[model samples]
Target: MRKNLRVAAYAICVRDDRILLARSPAADGTPEWVLPGGGMEHGEDPYDTVVREVEEETGYHVEVTALLGVNSLRRTFPGRLLRRPTDHHGVRLLYEARIVGGDLRNEVNGSTDLAAWQDLDAVTGLRRIPLVDAGLRLWRERPAGGRVQPP
Candidate 1:
């Protein structure tokens, strides 16, 4: 049994009735919206990871105010970079972050194609990555300082 703990940080950056999202670029160069942030590096704090990732992905400095919740997920990728039935359990720490500095700009050297604010309702109809809904739901009905069980 090969199990790897993948810790990641995500920020729910909201301002003026909209949320900041990174439009992920597909292999064919298509776009799909997702929450801003990414994986945490070894020995890095989750709080710092969220701030760093949000800035790197969305070009905005964020101040992580509260710890939302954790999510555990399993993924299997075949014919991918990661093979051999690896159990990737993620401890996703969501945060309520306020944009403190940095201009909103699409990172020229990054994974996403677009970095901008989008209507929260607009997300309902659009095709989004899994983490988007999870992050939003967590942001809306935040836990009473506890963990969110996996469904």
Candidate 2:
């Protein structure tokens, strides 16, 4: 089996009873709602990655207010590109972010297509990735150890 590892950063921006989210491509290239962030580039800092990804996916400049927690997830699944079973591991840094500027807009020619602010209570009804739930948990709980179970 092949193995894959991904390190990513995400922003949890909540204000006025809503959270910012984007319709991002899932493992199968289908769109699903997710936090406004993605994987880090080679030699890129996670902090910078979160800022850049938030802007790219949501068209908003954000300042990370707090490091919420880290969520590590692992699974074995059939790989789309390899056409074989693979072990995938992901380490995500979730941050509490404050939107400082820019307007809400859909991402063009990128991994995510649509951006929107969903009511906190309404989020449970949306088709979304686990990261969304994990991030929100971290934000609400404010875990002292900065670690959370993968949702």
Candidate 3:
């Protein structure tokens, strides 16, 4: 099996009682909601990655405020492009961000299809990526170590 490791960053942008989210384009199957960010480019700072990704996905210029936390997950799944079962590990840096400028809009010809601000309380009803919940947890209870505490 092929092994793959991905390093990425995500933004947790909340205003009023809503949270910004991006609807990922259907790839593995059903489209899922995700935080507005993606894998880091070669030698790119995670902070820069977050800023660029947010604009690409949500059409919003954002300023990353604080480092929230990190979350990692590993899984085995069939690859979309390679068409083979593969082992994948994803390391994600979550950051608190604020929209500084630009108008809200959906991404075009990107990994994500749409962007929207969802009611925080209504998020539970959406088919979302696990990172959304993990990021929210980190945002709400900021641990000193910048890591999620196991229950």
Candidate 4:
């Protein structure tokens, strides 16, 4: 089995009852709506990662306001050859962010293709990534520990 771990930062930007979201360009045909952020670079702080990723994916400069929470998820799936199983773990940092500059645009030839603001109530009807729900839960509930509580 092969094991991999990824640390990522994501921003939850909401204004006028709408939330900013990016559409993943996954080649596996599982594309879905996600928050505007991605994996951190080497030696990069999660705060910086959120800011940088937001700009890259949404073409908008963001100010990370508050740490919403952290989420950890793991999955095991077949590797390239479908022979070896790969274990993947992701540690994601969720933050509340505000758009400070730039215009809304989709990422070009990147992991994500589209960026848009969707109505908060309409989000439930959209096909979305799990992180979207997790981030929104953190924002709405605001656990004292800055982490999602298992229920």
Best by lDDT: 3
Question: Which residue pairs overlap in candidate 2's backbone?
Answer: none
Question: lDDT value for candidate 1?
Answer: 0.82
Query: What are the per-residue Cα lDDT tens digits for candidate 3 across 26-145?
Result: 556798999999999999999999999999999999999999989999999876785878899999999999999999999999998899999999998999977899899999999888
TM-score of 3: 0.91
- For model 3, the stretches where C-alpha displacement exceeds 4 angstroms are 26-28, 78-84, 149-151
Model 4 lDDT per residue over 1-151, tens place: 9898999999999999999999985557777899998999999999999999999999999988999999999999776755688799999999999999999998998889899999999999999977899899999998999877655
Instruction: Give residue 134's lDDT in candidate 4 (0 to 100).
Output: 88
Off by over 4 Å in 2: 27-30, 79-84
TM-score of each: 0.87, 0.91, 0.91, 0.94
Please write out the lDDT profile of model 1 over residues 1-151, one tens digit for every residue: 4678888989988788898998887656677887888888989999999999999888888888888887768875444555566667877888889999999988777777788888888888876787788887788888786455544
lDDT of each: 0.82, 0.92, 0.93, 0.92
Assess the local accuracy of residue 76 in candidate 1 as a C-alpha lDDT between 0 and 100. 57
Clashes of each: 0, 0, 0, 0
Root-mean-square deviation (CA) per prediction: 2.4, 1.9, 2.0, 1.6
- Write down the TM-score for model 4: 0.94
lDDT of 2: 0.92
